[model samples]
Target: MGLVGAATGPSDGRRARVRIADVALHAITRRAARRIDHIIGDSTQARRATELLKELADLLL
Candidate 1:
């Protein structure tokens, strides 16, 4: 397994307090960051990208 897979693997005899909502939000944020980075690189679609990013931020928050 890779780094993320190993880190998130079955417990190692230790209690780790992790919230489901927090985990979901973290995954969503990572995905959004990658998409926004790609969109921001294209100058011609900037206006639409900005609007979409705002909408995504509103949903995430």
Candidate 2:
């Protein structure tokens, strides 16, 4: 859970706090990507989904 934040910074109480909104966005992006990947024989929907995922991923980066 808190592993990443704990591991990234100094042990001298300098570790950054994790933002809840960022975590939620990441989880949502992963789910959206999976949904896009699972689309079967639907080019239009798949393309739109891919575009949306790309936009969401940009926020992450």
Candidate 3:
């Protein structure tokens, strides 16, 4: 019992908070990319930004 208690000590609420933070960061990053795409008008920059967005999304899962 002691071992089990120690292993599972972190609460569900803490996990939820971390998940929310990741989601918020992902949204902010995408938004920034979109704004940069609008300003730069460069295909290469757009592609790199899109790749970054995909990577950030994969991290969420």
Give me the candidate number with maximum lDDT: 2
Better of 2 and 3 by TM-score: 3
lDDT, model 1, position 51: 89
Clashes of 3: 0
Cα displacement (Å) at residue 57, model 3: 0.2
Candidate 1, residues 1-61: lDDT per residue as tens digits? 2213223336664644444465667887798777455547777688787789899999999
Each prediction's Cα lDDT score?
A: 0.64, 0.67, 0.61
Ranked by lDDT, the better of candidates 1 and 3 is: 1
**Model 1 worst lDDT run, 10 consecutive residues:** 1-10
For model 1 the TM-score comes to: 0.37
TM-score of 2: 0.37
Off by over 4 Å in 2: 1-38
Q: Which stretches of candidate 3 lie over 4 Å from their true place?
A: 1-37
Per-residue C-alpha lDDT of model 2 across residues 1-61, encoded as one tens digit per residue: 5424333346656666554466767887798777434554588887787899999999999
User: Any runs in candidate 1 off by more than 4 Å, and if so which?
Assistant: 3-13, 17-44
Candidates 1 and 3: which is better by TM-score?
3
